[model samples]
Target: MTQKITIDGKDYAVGKLSEEARNQVVNLRVCDQEIAHLKQRLAIAQTARAAYASGLRKALASAEVVEH
Candidate 1:
């Protein structure tokens, strides 16, 4: 089966992709999606770590030193 694609008032023809091309295209799309998810997770972790560090610093500063 073939397909017709139109772009900017121009008509283009695309035929069925070969097996290798189909596999690679699908793999690339999956990899891109995985990368996007990982980046989002990394950002969330970094934000949480920063907030934790800031809280720790504040707690340490407010601690009273007891000389016994």
Candidate 2:
């Protein structure tokens, strides 16, 4: 069976790839979803990191100093 794939606004024919190649394509699609999820997780982590840094800075500024 033949399948058409659209890439860059152009249609290309992709058919009868080897079994290994087809498996690789399927694996790549799964990896793509994982990458997307990781990106979202990274964004949340960054936000948390920024908030922690801000709180740390405020805490440092508000700390009591002891003079000798």
| lDDT of candidate model 2 versus the reference | 0.82
How well is each residue in 16-48 modelled by candidate 2, as lDDT tens digits? 566776677678789989999999999999999
Candidate 1: residue 35 lDDT (0-100): 100
On TM-score, the leading prediction is 1
Candidate 2 regions with alpha-carbon error over 4 angstroms: 1-15, 66-68
Over 4 Å off, model 1: 1-16, 64-68
Report lDDT (CA) for all predictions.
Answer: 0.78, 0.82
lDDT of 1 by residue, 1-68 (tens): 46654546965443555677566666877998999999999999999999999999999899986788
**TM-score of each candidate structure, all chains considered together:** 0.68, 0.67
Question: Which residue pairs overlap in candidate 1's backbone?
Answer: none
Task: Rate residue 55 of model 1 by lDDT.
Answer: 100
